[model samples]
Structure formats: structure tokens, C-alpha cells
Target: MKIIVFLGPSLPRSEAASIIDAEFRSPVAQGDVYEATLIRPDAIAIIDGYFGFQPAVWHKEILWAMTQGIHVFGAASMGAWRAVELGPFGMVGHGWIYEAYRDGRLEGEDEVAITHGPAAVGYKPISEALVNMRRTFASAADAGVMTVDTARQLVQIAKRQFFPKRDYEAVITAAQLPAAQAADLSHWIRRHAIDQKRRDASSLLHWFSQNINYLSAPKRVAYQFSATVFWAQAVELKRREMLSRYPGRKLDHARIEQFTRQTMGNADVQCRQQRLEQCKP
Candidate 1:
């Protein structure tokens, strides 16, 4: 069965590959899923995805993929969010993070957001996710490392900070706990902090491995895909982008022009050209 996983800082690619053999791509961004659909993989699993710094994967493209019979699974960070939103549309969700979002226990993007290094360095996380921190704090409290009240306080503090600035040290320090308690909490976290996103991502990979046979068949969905003008434009753009990567390949400019004219009227084309020219130096 052919499967593709979109992954990044939620878990190391090596670790994920160890759990399941699949084509692993970097964190998904806008147009990435549309590109994936062109390959017609039996299934696509989303673990991590780009947001804040890039255009996020569109829900429409995912729906389109499902309509095309590609099974889509979501978990971990961005995947969890997308799954919760698209669950009714036949996008499968897996693991604790997905459950939390689906059950409405989690409500914000910041819950999974974290600052991370580039892919060159393996997408190393520089900031902690609020969800992981919440889990860690709850675990610590349950273990008697801190009071439940203290854990709640820490969660509030972590939530207050912007996602990129949220980290263990920053949240603990801002809590202003006593020296001994702070020390204990810090030590406990070093040894026991729960990486909910990573765990969820690992679970997703394993689930995919186990379900490979069942997932080999195309997915069936009740809803019909509506190809709006924007979707057509997106598909054309993705097509051109893919073609551009192969220098030796020829582009069907005549067909592209015809498609452009059909999807985007002459006036819209002129307006877009004007805007592009205005941005030129």
C-alpha cells in the first residue's frame, strides 16, 4: 500500500520511519496536499504542518483528496486540528491530541504551536508546546512533584505567553514559585516532561502500519467535491510548480492559458497582472 506522511518537529523522521515505512515529506504547507493527491497515494497521513510562517494546508484541498478516494489521516500538531475540523468529512483522526481536539478539550492553535529549527537541523523544537506542558504539569502534580494549584498556575502562565516564547524555563520562572519548589519542578520536567505531540505522531505512524492492508483501497465519502474557481487556480498553480522543478520537462502553456482564461476571467487576469507589476521594483 502506498502511503505518504507529512511530518516535522512533532517527531524525528528516523523514529517515525522505524515505526512505519512510508514516504516522509517535510511539514505540509499550502498546495502540498494538492501535490500529493496528484500521485494518488492510497493514503496520506498528516503529522506536522507549517503555519504562522507559511500558508497553511487548505481544508478544501484535503476534501478534494478525499473526494478523489485518497484516505486522509490527521494527528499530532496541525494534523490534529485539521482532523477535528474535517472529521465529519471523512478525514480520519488518531491519538490523544486528536481526541482532545475532537472532544473540545483543546481549542487553540497555540496548544500545539512551537518554535523549531529548520529541516537542515532535523526540525529541532526550540520552544515547548502548551499541550505538552499541560500534560507534563498534570503528570508532575499527580506524582506529587507539585500541587495541582501550582500546575494550574503554570498552565495559565504558559498560555499567556506567545507560542514562540513559550518554554519550560520561561513559564516556571514567571510562576515565581519558591527556590526549592522551582528546582524540584525543573528537575522533574527534565526527567518526565510528556511530549504529547511526539507520542501522538508515533501512534499515528503505527496505526498506519497496522492498517496498511485495509487502507490500500480508496476511501469512500458521502460528500461531493465542489471545484470552485479558487480551487482550480490552486490546482493550476501546483501543476506549474511541479513542472518547473523538472527543467527538461515542457509545459502545456496553451492548455494552461486556456484554463486560466476559463477559471479567471480576462478582467481578473488584468487586475492580477496590474497588482504584480505594482509590486515589482
Candidate 2:
């Protein structure tokens, strides 16, 4: 089965390949799933995805993929969040973060978000994820590195900061506790931090490997696929599958845009000169 995985930051592509043996893609954004459907892949697993800095993967694309017989799986980062919303439609969710989100224990996107470098730099994480910090805090408390109350306070403090700026150091500084106490807590976290996102990412890879055969099986669902007008436009844009004016010829998006511009320019276009004169900047 051809399995395409949208990935980044949570795990390196090389390591994911060694484990899941699927085509590794950059963190997903708008139109990625629609593009993946053009490949006719049997499955798609999402581990990381973009939002805020870029468009996020669309839910309609996921639903469309499922209706087309592609098994969809999501875990970690934005992937897990999508799964929670789409699970009733046959999208499978994996990992602890998914569990937390599904059960309402975690409700914020920043709980799994981290600022990171670009692909050329291997998407190196700049800010820490709230999920990782919370996990680390709980681990530290269990290991007697800090009190449970202290860990709880830290978790709350981290959540209060903007997601892009929520690192452990910032959380400690924002707490405004004594310097000695902050220093010791920082040192303890340095020694015992938990990488919940990475761990969940690994779980997805392993699950993909073990369940490859079944993943591509046709989904038996109660609801039929709905093709809305917006979804049609989205697919046409992303896949460039527009039927050409020439019979049996399909034009890609670039060619279609070229045709439109040429047709419009040649056909006598209205400059809207009167409207422009009246409009205020």
C-alpha cells in the first residue's frame, strides 16, 4: 500500500522512513491532502502540520480521502487535533496526545505547538511544546525532582504565555519565583524533560509499520461522501485537474491561469476606472 505521511519537527524524515517506510512530506498545509489524493495513495498519516505561520491542512480533504478509500491516521501536533475532530468519519487517532484531546483533558493547540526552523535546518524546534513540558513536569514530580503542586503551577504558567514564546525558561521567568528556586527547577527540567511529541510521533510510525496491510482496507462508513462547491474549487486549485476547453485534455493550474489571463485581456476587459475614482484608500 502506498502510505504518504505529512511530517516535520516531531521526527526527522530519515528516522521516520526507517520506521514507517512511507513517503515523508513536509508539515502539511492547505491543499496537501488534496494533492496527496492525486497520487492515489492507499493511506495518509499526519504527524505534524502548519498553522498561524501558514495555512493548515483542510478537514474536507481528509474526509474526501477517506471516501476515496484512503485510510487516514493522525497523531502528534496538529495532526492529533484533526483526528479528534474527524474520528467519527473513520479517521484513526494514535498516541497519548490524541487520547488527551479526545477525552477533553487537553483543549489548547499550543499544548502541542512549537516554533521551529525551516526544512533546510531539519525544522529544529525553537520553542518547547506545552505537551512536552507538562509531561516533563509530571515525570519530575514522580521522580521527586519537584513537588506536584510546583509542577502544576509550572504547567499553568507555560500555558499563559503565547504559544510561540512558551519555552521552559520563559515559563520559569514569568512565574517570578525566587532565583534559587527557579535555577533548581530549570536544572531539574534540563535533566528530566520528556519529549511527548517525539514519543507520540514514534508511536505513529511503529503503528503504521505493523498495520500497513490493514490500513489500506476500504472504509465501511454510514455516511456517503458530499462534494460541496468549495471542496470542488479546492481540489481543482490544488490538483489542477480542470478539464480543458479541448476535449479529453486536462490543463494544470498554471496553464488554466495563463488561458484565463489571455482570454480576459483579449476579450475587452473593464478597467473599473469609475469605481476606482470614487473609492477611498
Q: How well does candidate 2 score on lDDT at residue 130? A: 93
Query: What tens-digit string does per-residue lDDT give for candidate 2 at 50-118?
Result: 998677899987887776678888998888999999999889999999999999999978899889999
Error of 2 at 8 (Å): 0.8
Residue 172 lDDT in candidate 1: 91
RMSD, one per candidate, in order: 4.2, 7.6
How much lDDT does candidate 1 score?
0.86
lDDT values of the candidates? Answer: 0.86, 0.79
TM-score of each: 0.89, 0.83
